[model samples]
Target: MLKIEEIQEIIKLIDKSSINEFIYETNGTSVTVKKSADEYTIQQPAAVTAPPVIQQIEKPAEPVVQEQAPQIAAAEPATSTKKTVDYDYEIVSPMVGTLYHASSPDSDPFVQIGTKVSSNTTVCIVEAMKLFNEIEAEVDGEIVEILAEDGELVEFGQPLFRVKK
Candidate 1:
């Protein structure tokens, strides 16, 4: 567990620093951090000619919440309690294609933080062969995480959600 003082220091550093990416590894855990501009565009590595999915080049005013260190400590021994690894469900891609967060360039994303999603919800779009396909959920659960960026090309079975059962 991270100390409160350390968590505060990390938040301060994140606010004061502008190095869009940061990584820290300690105690067998690795944390990767990124702060993108509103456009939230990601650069494709050289030698990879595929275009990036996210094309927004302008900055958006998303609130910044550097981690504050989990308040609750880890669980006790496994025998003390059943592990909560039983996820309610996961949304996975059906094909290898580019994922899009919105229907169009100037439209709102299909989903956002705290968005309640039901089974068959259209969470995002995946474009293949110049055709846009709506990717829907296969199970009912609150979205706990969006594993891929907007316009990211996801492979078959790639994780798209970390849902609470």
Candidate 2:
């Protein structure tokens, strides 16, 4: 809370300054005092950060190549070579967390559509409680569609992939 004298002082400062807006910070208290059109406003921040001294970096996109499709297919989902069976299964997330495609920073992914899988095969990994848990296939199927993006936070019962078993 501010004292009446402090409020009066702020009002006096506003009347004196011709600038459209003003802001000041001290101790743990910071206030953004501003005037827009004919309205006056004040906002106090709960947390503060020291203004950074730096420059921004920009990123450029790599050129797309048609030859990379095969590499991307292999890189994104490395399939298993084994027997097959017929089953209808929906690959749902086991928990509420972020979904990951690859196993490690340098490694390729575990599974993708047209990738042969068994009931014990790990299709993807989900992160929960700061721990990565392997999501396995309940039944063998070809991944028909991926319903979520990499590093996307998912909820329980979220359809991660639609499988054609």
The model with the greatest lDDT is 2
lDDT of 1 by residue, 14-71 (tens): 5455545444444444433344432111121223333322221222545665533322
Best by TM-score: 1
Regions more than 4 Å wrong, model 1: 1-86
Which stretch of 10 consecutive residues in model 1 shows the poorest summed lDDT? 37-46
Error of 2 at 139 (Å): 0.3
Residue 22 accuracy (lDDT) in model 2: 59
lDDT of 2 at 88: 69
- TM-score of every candidate relative to the true structure: 0.48, 0.47
TM-score of 1: 0.48
Q: Judged by lDDT against the true structure, how good is candidate 2?
A: 0.65
